[model samples]
Target chain A: MNIRGLSLETIPPIFTPFRFFLSAPLSGILAAILLIYSGTDIWLTRWNINNLALTHLLTIGFMLIVMLGALYQFIPVMTGQLIPGSKKLASSIHIMISLGVLTLVTGFLSHSRIFFILALFFLGIGLCLFAGSLLPLLIARLQNQLIVFLLRILYLVLMVTLGLGLYMLLAHAVPSLEIDFRNYTDLHVLWGLAGWIVLIIMAISSQVIPMFYVTPEFSRNYLKMLSLAILITLVSLSLYQGGYIKALEVLLTLELLIFVVYTLHLIGQRKRKIADVTIYFFRLSLVSLLVGIIIWWLGRYLAQQTFYFLLAIVMIYGLAISAITGMLHKIAAFLIFLHLQKLSLSRPTAISLVPNMKQVISSQNSWIQFMLFLLSYAFILVSVFFPQLTVLAGVFMLLSFSWLAYCLFQAIRRYQKIQLEILALPEMKMSI
Target chain B: MAREIILDVSELEPPQPFEEVLKQLRKLQAGEYIKMLHRKQPLPLIQLLHENGYAVSMSNSPSGLWEIIIWKMSDPVSAADCNTQFGTNIIQADVSSNR
Candidate 1:
């Protein structure tokens, strides 16, 4: 636990976080492409096993993968503590988790019980290892009020999601369990989206938004209130599913309104006033959130499956992916900078080892990705009503995802080159 | 005449616990000066001191160690005044020579 020994080389600390960060978005791009290739009609046919697979491709593959990566990076910085497990243990966990995600997605699509069981086993081990590494650091650093509170809540919700997943898998394997799939599935989505995703976003936004823009501190009171409201509403919805749906919807609407206000306030207060690609993503995501709510409201009134499908597409593809992409741009650059800064202290003259983040990811690429994403989304919306344009929507989505993956891959290669430069430094000269 | 007060704090960490260190720095007589030596960059501490109405100057030693000197603005008139008033070397001696 010696501070000096916690160097980058000794721990290879950045590896998993970087890997996960790159992998999550790239997998997401691939998932998006897969959904598009399947055609809008097939993608929206929720009863189809392929639809479930496509959903998990985004949810488990892209969302959870990236979320876990961010968690690993943020937890240490947030708590001022290192991850508990050994490097070997962490690498193994990463491998298992990657394999598990692939297997589970494949199994769910094919309805292969063996793959399902194996996926469950691998994923469970990986998640347990991750939780084990994080939970202790959280407990020891309970003094950081924001971090401790968010981490605790996130962990609990993760457990709930995992539990539901386990039960669903079990139900698939054993019919006698007699669990209602619809009932648990709603709880599962609730925990996954509202609990895990939203809570983490709340926690991270507090730190990142201020830091990135060098803005004045956000109203801590407002953030805390929002967090509490979201947490309470989610919990209530989980417990009282049918009865609390209306109330939950109201709460969600209020939360979204607050978020929009907060985001506007942040942008207004930002030191750098110029528009950035990440900001574009943030704006798109917020718009998507608003649109998704409207679609949900419409679905409630009309009871149309198309509206529900539109809601999912907007929320998942438009909002979630945009926000995640925006975040990755900043987080990846920051991590690379942090590592380089640390390295520079040891090897000040080592061939100028820092990566130019601006060059690594271009605004043009981001804009292209964003436009393609919107085009695909528009196609999907059109297809839901028209059904004929589904194939075209699918094609657009596939192209957008492919472009995103390429952009991410280029960024990662830049990261690797920077790592190599550091490695090439002599032992005496190079810092961890 | 601006006066110099020397504070030899060679034992602080980077982004030094500024409030705690400031309390000791503030106790200097209105015309005295202080100098601190620390291993890491003292940018945060220097900024904190400046914000609290202290005039400060910073230089790095030949070995890349930090030397921060602080003085009350009201007392200093001449370089000689600083040198003779404190009865101690206003200019820091090379510590690497001893090493």
Candidate 2:
């Protein structure tokens, strides 16, 4: 077992994580609105200005936002390592990143050098502040555990990816910088998506699947070696030429295939066969990842430009976003209940008013939200082929994120209201 | 001999595990302490127990699961007996007050 920081105390206050979670979906909602506004033009090619904006909206806004929030919560709770100056530091990180994403999206859509400069500024501070605070702690954590090890890799990847992104943005910001925007942009995307995002997801899911769901543990050595294998392939992709690149791509795909198959195997072995909404999200994410891999293979073999765009859509909206949305539902509900339970520990008489996880966010409501997200996924997949269906896809996407926002809002409201009740108790009044 | 309340929540998910532990605690008698088997250390539950004047001692079982012993501090002997019975070190927590 990966015993590292179980003895450490101090999970950050609930709002520390929730602030990131609540705002992350707004980017998804904005991306959908952009699609509704642009319609067919947004589906034309990945290079289209509005399409680039939409991609950032999902990537930085939705995926990275949720991840930063998770790391804020996870590093402390799982590793038993507390973040120093977390409240002020966390708030600053959130604001900078939220502005970074908005300005980045605006920069993409407007093709303005000034907005690009602003994005570069905001994202730079936000990402640096994040890495500055956590990277040292993660590196210093003394364990041969896979999570700590993989988190180190994740931080390094983020730094390198940020370096590549800086170069790309500088070319736009300064206009005369000696940078091959097209060639290097591909490297930035590869490092950001495949290296940074994919590896972190792999590391976390390996830990939580068994820990939370009563499934068999993923082999620690296997995952560690796989992390190295992916790093090797991504490094090889950046260095190699035409013929060798195809082989490298195959190596990465094989790694993903193993992940999908093994995850499905683990899910099948779950002691409790009753599936939750989070399980469905994972299954959907797995299938979408497989679908993305297939699309890439077909697009490469057939030399069809359209399939590449389809591949991008599947990976971003279908795989990453779907998983994150499901994660928000599960984590937010639990934290609300857990923190409320903490409140009642002080005011023992108010214990009954602190609802269980199910009461906080009903299974039926979450399942319905998951269904909406799946429909949004389908409409988006279809829209890639039929450009006219773009607006309809956008509408469904908006509804899914809006409802996610509502669900989160209600859960937080419950937390606040119950908090007020606990403070108002007769015992509380007398103690005061 | 102190009575034992065996709780094996190795398969239950979150909030359910917390609820089950609390429910089981309410049913305890003066001479009993819970011998709870869990997959991971239930740290939050342990904290709550100590705050409410319950004592806890935990160590890994042969089954590779955590075996946590919880009792009222007034009944420390039962918790100590459990440590001896399970061949675990006695690592008691007594916060006694939340405020």
Candidate 3:
């Protein structure tokens, strides 16, 4: 593949990704509201209707939304080709998935067959549309790179997970399906979380952490081999469930351990050391993974729901959310800075001052959000045991997401105001 | 005599390299050229330069630095002449008419 063909010319408009990013925090806020409304029942078990609703809200509504947006922007950087019809495709997918997730959440909370049917139609169609647009791009131009290999595996796993999810939804919608729901749920969750979510994070970091931070590049040889190792372990785990391949499981644990250590080392080695909030988010994610992995490993011996609950909390709120938040900070600032620089070039006299990354989105604002995020995370952790503290956690979560949405909305507004100023210039009539 | 501006961009991250190079390009004059050294080829920057009546010759040297020597459309010292100075991957895009 001619990777160079994937340049800025091929990149979609900034608004394509921004739309998805702006919607993400609202979903987080919704999840928090669901938690608050569910009250004590949410703590009963992972299978609790409210618990399922909250998890889907975070997983589908927040993380997947952010990931899709990131991919629309990053794919050009990676592959030198844009997904075809990016803006329209993104807008349509966003609408379908957003509404689909809402319906799915309602289905879970109310246990209504009609809601389940609507969710099945919406989410299944929305996700499949995303896959339909994305898969061909990867297959045609992504070549044999390690990221591509892993992405292929990730996409396949996502499809399987989605398929199982639809099957379960159908089973709920139609009672005579005779499908084994319990066992399938285990596979679906594992594939969705571990296979797709965790693996994509690890793979993207192998490139991003180095390039974005000016840190040491991850060992190329290890990176080259890691995709296959992760794929094999996932497949093995799928087959074994909790049985043989103890060695494979051990290897998976080792891989995660290396991630924690490497992230710490990378942060220490960063070229610009005057504290950034994104670094804190990265550290939070890595530490959460370490803690989550340890709790999960220990769960093998304890066989208790508390360990699993803590693990889920750390995974969803701590690791996944933190990672997305960190990446979002950088991506948002970079894209804004880029477009501003472009405008500066196009209308040099009209736009004399282009904002730098920090000016676009202040570090202080991000820190405020980060602190709120941490407070909410702490509350959620405590609520895992206390159950009643969920209300407090929910309140903090609402504040955190509201702050994030406001910051992003303000940045985009700033971008637009500058754009209008540039366009209003009499000299800018012909050039750009 | 031709004027040469050298920018060392190896330590910077991402679009900074792209941005700094463009900022410098705005100051370019007739018979002047820029020599930018970065860790990776600034592909978008190269595209921008091509469209703005500038030509670029990029090389990944044995020392692991990308040297992009850029000159005006009228410059007699072509990107081909600079290709012999570096080790691998020479990219020369001439779009002076588009300017």
> Pick by lDDT: which candidate is best?
2
* Candidate 1 per-residue C-alpha lDDT over A110-199 given as tens digits, one digit per residue, 9 for 90 to 100: 788888888888888888887777776666633336656766777787788877887787676665777677668767876776566666
- List candidate 2 stretches off by more than 4 Å: A1-8, A301-304, A426-432, B1-4, B50-55, B74-99
lDDT of each: 0.64, 0.78, 0.76
- lDDT per residue for candidate 3 within A28-77, as digits (tens), equals 88988887787777788778888888888998899889888888887655
Per-residue lDDT, model 2, residue A426, is 48
Question: Between prediction 1 and prediction 3, which has the larger DockQ?
Answer: 3
Better of 1 and 3 by lDDT: 3
**Model 2 residue pairs with clashes:** none
TM-score-based ranking, best first? 2, 3, 1
Model 2: per-residue lDDT, tens digit, A32-119? 8998999999766678889888888888898888888898887665564566556679999999989998988888888888998998
DockQ of each: 0.04, 0.27, 0.27
